[model samples]
Target: MSKELRINSNKFIDQTTRLSFKFNGEKLYGYKGDTLASALLANNIHLVGRSFKYHRPRGIMTCGSEEPNAIVQIGNDPSLTDPNVRATEIELYEGLEAFSQNCWPNVKFDIGGINNLLSPLLPAGFYYKTFMWPASFWEKYEFFIRHSAGLGKSPTKPDPDIYDHKYYHCDVLVVGGGISGIMAAKLSAENNNETLLLDDKNILGGATIYQNNDCFQIDSTHTNYWLEKEIKNIKNIKNLTIKTRTSLAAYHGYNYLLAKENLTDHLSPDERKGKIRQRLWKIRAKKVIIATGSIERPLIFNNNDRPGIMLSSAIKKFIDFYGVKAGKEITLFTNNDSAYETAISLKKSGVNIVSIIDIRDKSSSKIVKEVEKHNIKIYWKHTIVNTEGYRRISFIEIMQLSDDGSGVIGKKIKLKTDCLGISGGWTPMVHLFTQSGGKLKFRSDDNVFFTRQE
Candidate 1:
């Protein structure tokens, strides 16, 4: 059920090898390098699941670890079926079966949707407030409450996968495998340090690897090309060890860390037999370098959680990295310059860019100037007031911001766009840094809290 969203050819995805998988019992096809989320978007399957409380529709929100929706159950076996797995993280494999969660009788026509109408009577913690008053009927209410709660089912039998643990000590440990992490690993290793780099991905190089823009250059060469050359240089460093598909789980005192390294999650069932499925790494490093990058903040508006609404960064990766078009007609909304990057990428791919709605006054940056050259429509000081569409976004209503930027002042203008990409700038990932006895200072300008040093 491919929607023909794929571009002609992509070096990253192996289109020659087509693998079929099941989603809600219907077979779908994806390439060797496609994630379950990317494949669904390619098949034009939005509105994958339903919200837990109100049963409002939910779709694949993000492309990576920060995904808030698109959770599904994998497999049908009593012993091997895995639940609560993020669709964005699961790599496409042969014979894989995934079903949407949090709904009964399927996601499209869930009976639990009645709760949305009853939402006024079922606010947060309403079950505790409404049910506990009559203590005599507690047992009667328990049966119905338990049946209505929780997502996915637990395995009925013992897990049949192998799990192992190991220990190591390194002079320096660098987290994240983006361009910054790659350079950090290489520099640490070059100084005769036993450096270890960890990234929770099957492939190395983060979002920067897919950045093929002409303006993003290094020494007269595109940044992607330059970073690829650096990746090759780090592989030969004897003191450096790079571990992909591994995640750091905990940070303990005395420079001790706990990491989970997946061994065969991406491989097919037959290929995974008798192999270590996952390995827990207990490492002690003299020093730790946390280069865990930032996450793009999303804009908030009425009905912003619609299926076709996604982060601008995610749309960029879907096209440039996965070689899939998010939508045939797309519009972007932003308060920063990042969404312009998405607009440029979409324009280069021969996709129709309806327009760009920026909440701030116009400024002429080099990238913004380049977008102006394309003669794309720009609505300055405008904000999305509401979105329209039942399952996927079909139209967006925008209004010019007031002089004080607190309210709307002009008449609402409606635009037809299948996909809406919104960017609210980036928030630095400082959880690991703050967890290790570090404090943070709130930066209100960009709406981010950054680590503050002593």
Candidate 2:
């Protein structure tokens, strides 16, 4: 067990910063300036959820949108609960109740473990195979399937809280707060363009704040500081509004974007103070640069739904940004160059990395060379075939894959570990580009789809 810590409420907020919250129906306390994820971490409660299929244990994986775990059912009523919400991203207020999703009875103990014993009988798209067998019994079997599917639960009652949408005008809009986002914002501010940078996280420093993570090879904090200095130096372009606790939900023609602001939920349920809980900001920009970044794709395999398995990017946020250790031992499975940064970062953080299983044949890339220097063992043309763990990942079975990636056809390798980090590749969030009617094409080099000329 880890040590538990609490806020010295009296020092941070006036009128005694006491707020009530609940997790799994057990009431807890929170204070002002606490996001649901942070508050939960403060309590030393690591397991907040379970895996999708195998009912394995899950903890918060990231602090921001990149989170793959820590998603929970918030609020008491059906309408109030936001399913699949990143706990680290939500601000906590008094009376904020949450519960683990994808778990039966409780997150710690689940009947789903039985799936592991019968895993060999399951594979990717197993549901498609099982539902057809009896044909006549499909209807009866569907009930059990539905109950075991999906993350989070629906509230039985209506939501008591209110949520609403605002329109503003800006000369420039930056969609991310990472290095690129900050650089764009700084440049816009310098050019005297009324600039606004929007990010869903509570802090303006995006991935840079987690400098200890392996992905952060450069000095992210220094870059952030330079951006801050640049913002301060400009007198004319200084009219910039950086929305940290805001997300750009949509983009429209003429460069219009919609943003949402969470106002009161982080303080306490009763501390509304008659202020609007949320507001929508519609902004028109002459130019928009989306540093919106990318999301990790999970590898397809049998029993991949085991708990404790998540995107590698998520691990960085949990350990570096949240100051919370996700697991004692972690195994990273990747088919790309990016996940190597995660393995390196975890090793540097004193977290034991069981091994790195890479599916690539060979790489002349600089990152691959670095992996060799670090002495991190790499598996070529291999992928995870199955996993075993309950409420958390305990071990993984990897097998060599056919060159065409249609199937696995080599000897199996197994490693003992607690967490499994996977990344098939990345999916650039090109919603805005597509919403603007932009076309996307496959990029052979990146092995991803990117916006291309029509």
- Highest lDDT scorer: 1
Tens-digit lDDT track for model 2 on 253-338? 88877888877656555567566778788788888888877777878777676556667877755554444445667788888877
Query: What is the C-alpha local distance difference test score of each model?
Result: 0.91, 0.70
Which stretches in model 2 have alpha-carbon errors above 4 Å? 4-21, 26-63, 66-70, 77-84, 92-95, 101-104, 107-165, 212-237, 364-375, 401-410
TM of each candidate vs. truth: 0.98, 0.75
Q: Worst lDDT window (10 residues) for model 1?
A: 1-10
State how far residue 357 of model 1 sits from its true place (Å).
Answer: 0.9
Question: Over the full model, what C-alpha lDDT does candidate 2 score relative to the true structure?
Answer: 0.70
Model 1 accuracy (lDDT, Cα): 0.91
**Cα shift from native, residue 309, model 2 (Å):** 0.6
- Once model 1 is optimally superposed onto the true structure by TM-score, how far is the C-alpha of residue 94 displaced, in angstroms? 1.0
Q: In model 1, what is the error at residue 164, expressed in angstroms? A: 0.5
| Worst window of 10 by summed lDDT in candidate 2 | 6-15
**lDDT per residue as tens, model 1, 1-454:** 4646888677788989998999999999999999999999989887889898999888887899999988989988999999989898999998889999999898888999899889998889898898996799999999999998898988999998889999999999999999899999999999999999999988888988999887799989888899999998899999999999999988888889999998888888889999999999999999999989999999999999998899999999999888888888999999999999998888888889999999989968989998999999999999999999977899999999999999998798999999999999999999888877789999987778998879
